[model samples]
Target chain A: MTTVLHSRLLNDVLRDILSPYDLPPVEDVTTRRQLARTLLSGQDNGSFNGLALAYAVVAFCTSTEDGATEVLAAVGDNADVLVLDGVRGGYLLLPCAQDQHVGLARALHDRLGSDVWMAVAWASRRDLASARATAEDVLRIASCRAPGVYELRNVLADFAVLRQPHVAERLARMIEPVVAQQPLLDSLRAFISEDGNRAAAARRLDIHRSTLDHRLRLVERLTGCRPTSPRALLTLSVALTAHSTPQVPLPRAY
Target chain B: MGRGQPVLFDVGRLLHEEFLAVYRAAAADADGWEDAAVSVARRVGSRLISAKVPVAQVVVALRSTDRLLTEAMLDDGGDARALAAAGTALAAELMSAFCAGDDDGLADALLAGSAPDGAAAVYTVALVRGALADRVVNAFRRHGPVLLATSGHLLLPVPEAAALPLCRDVCAELGGEVWFSVAERPAARVALARKEVDEIDALVTSLGRPPGVYRIDDMLFESAVLDTPEVRDELDKVVAPLLANPVLVQTVLALLEADGNRAVAVRKLFIHRSTIDYRLWQIEQLTGLSPVNPRDLALLGTAIGLSRTNALG
Candidate 1:
């Protein structure tokens, strides 16, 4: 069994745990003090006892308000859990069996249906110091993918591979020289997609095989990469994906 | 002071919520309990100001909180006069913070393109003839426009259906030429709309077109050509021979702008109708494409549009 509290409620409980009455002055004293003040003025006046408030993964969350509460209540009713309150949503603090939590998340998803987007994070109880960081990381990774229960390890690896700085810079440096030549760029994209098949790429571009070959030659001269090479093909394919993909903006700040 | 009673009530309600939380801390044996309440008040004041709640409404909310705190103190058998003095002091601190927050919110709104979220269309106004920017802006606001940003290029959020009528009214009111474009898209997409607006405005300016509501969607082909440099370059090459002669370029441009109406081109250029017809024939002889034919007119219009608008991207 483990002890955990809701992540959002941490900002509130942090005030009480790190108040001037409870702890010595620390490095982020000003920020702690501000939080403590906000907590004092907030409407949550409930008290806590006995349970050790530690970190836990948010296995799933929904967008709607009542749906979230119903799911939280249902999860609490079925399992030995604490349904902690959050300002915008609720969190489930599971004390035992991580599988039981995942099971509950799945059952909740079934109930909420596919319309609502759910999120999950990779967090551990022992990593209390990095709880907020873990939660934010999961949220960022989740934003890039579709709505579902996200497994953090795989998502993190995928994100790291796709977003490596040098990979992006190399792709851009090669593709920048051909951006203005729409027809050549289109042909290059088709050729890369068809696995460097000249016949297939020509059909896709609706051009003659000779025309496609000529375009490939021009592309090689422009980007300094041969389309026929496997390693070069992967880079070109990934480059086209990166070029065409629209970057979703972060959520607006108040 | 500019806020209504409902807004004041909203401020009071939110302040009360925060006050209860502060009261809980103060009632406990926590150190800095009194300072905590002051901090809470300041934070709440700042939030109200940032939300664009009026200063007077914030003052009313603070006063209401003070009254509630005073009543609670008396109920707890605290000295009434002492509580009153502390309440007055707290009120003064909160009011000062609230005013400071109001100023900060104004600055932030100016820096960010802060507006109500339901803005459906984006309008960019580029004032050309006179210093009538304020008058044009006030008219848009009167018709429920949310001013997103202003840097000479005024970005506003307006409804799509209301855009043309509103633009027509403003153009009539100002009584002078001002370049404008309306992009009937979501407000969040205004960055793209800004580019479209700039292109349309540039197109109007280069054509020496009179003040009117120019929808960005009207010049769909021209806009596409403008965004693609290679396509524009090709079109420029196609029209290069005619462009070499400034008079012929002007004649084709005038004819295209007049929508192939020779009489209209004649009137616009202050030349005889026969001269326009002769120029059209000369244009055909030079390029092997007559402006009088529908298919040839479109091709010629695109080429001329590319050559005429040097300001296009």
Candidate 2:
């Protein structure tokens, strides 16, 4: 079906799904995500011609019908496909096995070549209601990747919370006491970001593992939350997301 | 029954009837009558006050005769001039009333959580994005007679019947890109409803969810907590570790977004379940909070929300 046709159908399904929530029917992308979440929890449709696939991959690529068709064709008969429009260009949904993900993405890019640039993000019954939400994130992180098959995992680091203004303010303040100890904060950030991989975080920071440990201890002393602990790191990660945000402007005198 | 008392009674009765007639007539169609009515009332009310007429006595006299006066005015068959004059008398009596009953009614409704029987419903409108702010404000003004604003949100005190229509009109006029939230409280108490609307607005925004009119009950706990600076700061510390690795932070957020359903977080993040496990482990290792644990998950969810709120903004 055409992207518009699929989107309309999806919107109808979403509305039906969201009706229980009693939210005013505002047809916006954000609302769409909300509805999609409800569906992701297990709204069934025989139209996909399968009970469920291991994965649902979404792609934002060239708008041309031929480009989209070629991309879908490259996914082979193993998957069910749909295209959604009324957004940034067009979107493609291909539900397939995790095993087929890499091969399909590669084939599509190979066939479309430079004629189409593709950004892919995948979802599953476990977490994603639809690949629609992650497509943008994938597209954004796609910039750091060369033209080829790129899963969201490969470039997950590219998506930081600190990039938001309000968040950054809160985070900066949360760590304000320790912020002056630049080295310590830096070590903690690297350690957490590297998924607590001491060697990796040390390498990224160009510090010895022992020094990283020392800095981490300092972080513990300041925040009362050790850097190496999951619970503490979780808090630290949230605070770090704040760093990307632009400084909050003066509060408006309402 | 005394000779002088009888004459005085007749004059008072006639004046009271006249005042009631004008009031009923003007109320039937109040257009262009307020100025005349208020002026006449103020003149007469002040005069009576100056003449040592007790405000209570004047109000009681007006109240006792209101029904009879209204009946006479109705019998006049839409006589605008007489109606206008009666409105003036009524206004005078109203002014002389010992207290502002209507203001008191409003105050009662505003102060109470549940609206009193006659209180109108008030709503708080939050403008999330500024693009259609003017149009939305204008739309509310056009449809609702009373619009109150304080600090952040627009307070619309709408008649019961006007409530739904005003909401529909704004939605239709602005189109969907406009981000906003609407929640109703007692018209007098709409200012207090600001918290509800603000929470919903922040919740929806943090979730990267769509804009719509929402009730206070629609707000999610995670969204509400993250929206608060104090709570967000505390939660920020919990998730601060993952911030350096944006990807990992995103993973925790996805997990939190999925309510700690590892499989779901993996899907939202578009990563493998194995990857989700690894990240969850990393998160658990660094924070001593297991994604699988309900309490730990809630904490992580809060941190995720706090992060998303910032990132989305």
Candidate 3:
């Protein structure tokens, strides 16, 4: 028999046998392990021919108890979509064009609420594992920002910083003095939020323009980096983001 | 280096040790020196003021120490740039200490050219206050050093000829009322200059002159009136009737701010010219002080200023 025909026959037999009784939810540890084994077996035996096509792997975090089931339901009768449970959240494998990943993630994000953080990456059948890994990496880096849908492109800078922890550490050390001074740190944040407009930053901080200048000067004196200079400002800005982001590693992808 | 000045000696010793510490930290690890250097610099700066070291002497000492350290590092094939950078950080911290009123000597040194690169010898002192004091101070800093004193007062030193125009530009750019006083003083006597400016500021505040740069000479009339206790009461009585109507009061104040230009005052109030004309008429009928008459306008401006001050109090 052809591989596609054989896989279809096996899937139909399994569905017919399991359709008679309610199966355990995917949240059950044994059931999840069984499903993982079955998927791995399918990869080995070519039981799921759909896995051979290009797909978008999405990794997401959800606090709700039935998050796995909810995600599956959100994916909603899409024969090409596959869901896998992981330690913190779960993964969705959608066999679709690369350009559709963001729209799909956005739809999932809307369904899952703003509290969910999701990341997407594209891969072919053979690269599914690496795609899952990339999605998880993007998710970890983008988690520092507001929880929402993210892709590698959306978090390239943070991913760059995240990859070289030593550089991040040095950048973070540069702002250690600023981090200690609340008013100076607040001023820097306001200056950045105002897109480097001194008058607007002053208004935001409710301080005089001179006072903002003094505080920024103090920040430069402490960090050896001028907040007004483009290179130095980028260094300070990235350093602050890195410093505030938690450094813990994410759990391994399934 | 006398027994009476042990604190100064300690400051010198601490600065020396910290510079060495910074060099060693930099040599041992590139990233380790910043925190150690910054904390040590701040501590040494605070000690420099607490010891009451003369600002000029402190400048000389810091520069001498930096040169000596840099030269020693050069001889040893170490990073002289790191040592020099640490010194700059130390000086910046000391400037901060001076701004915080660590010592009068330090403040004087900052105003005067303790360092060869300090401000000019005969700079004019400007005391700036208001909602835009910070913006004005920052703008003034382009010309010279700006020292932020207690109670949000900014002491700026600029050339005498540049003072009025600079203040005008700041007020125009910032679009807010910033009351400031400018007094020409020798750099050595900025503290005294600040007091004189403060007095002029007080007199101007009492007279309720429109927000702009003021000199003591410009406020001679207001000063003469402020000296009499009954004059304020009399001035208050002159505009009290106009004050009862907030709209008329606003129109009179706007006219004064616009220098008796009704068109400009109408633009400021965002009202029709006829409305402003009617309001000014109402003000004149109520207070017997015509906004159109220069002398009457002056009296009305003073009354409004005193009334605003009283309301604030």
Measured by DockQ, the strongest candidate is 2
**Which whole-number lDDT from 0 to 100 does residue B271 have in model 1?**
91
Point to the candidate with the largest lDDT: 3
Mark the regions of model 3 whose C-alpha exceeds 4 Å error after superposition: A1-48, A63-72, A76-79, A86-88, A247-251, B1-313
- Could you tally the backbone clashes for each prediction? 3, 43, 3
Interface RMSD of each: 21.0, 10.5, 29.5
List RMSD in Å for every model shown: 29.9, 21.0, 25.5
Q: Whose TM-score is greatest here?
A: 3
**DockQ winner, 2 or 3:** 2
State candidate 2's DockQ. Answer: 0.02
Tell me the spans in candidate 1 whose CA falls farther than 4 Å from its real position.
Answer: A1-254, B1-131, B148-150, B155-157, B184-188, B228-230, B311-313
Q: Residue-wise lDDT of candidate 1 within A1-254, one digit each (tens)?
A: 21223334454345434542433233443443343232222321333222223323442344556655555555544222434344334334343233333443455566654333334432333442233333334444554446655443323222332444444455566677676698888888777556556798899889999998888788777865566543234445545534444332212111
Cα misplacement distance, residue B72 of candidate 3 (Å): 33
Model 1, C-alpha of B95: deviation from truth (Å)? 17
What is the C-alpha DockQ of each candidate? 0.01, 0.02, 0.00
**Comparing candidate 1 with candidate 3, which one achieves the higher TM-score?**
3
Winner on lDDT between 1 and 2 is 1
> Where does model 2 sit among the CAPRI classes?
incorrect
Which pairs clash (backbone N, Cα, C closer than 3 Å) in model 3?
A209-B134, A209-B135, A210-B134
* Cα-based RMSD of candidate 3: 25.5
lDDT tens per residue, model 3, A1-254 = 01122232354334424441333443454554453334422343444432434556787775554654566577645434456655447777655554666776786678764267788876555666766766776777676667888876554434545455555676677788899999999999887666566799999888999999999999988976667643345456666766776532333444
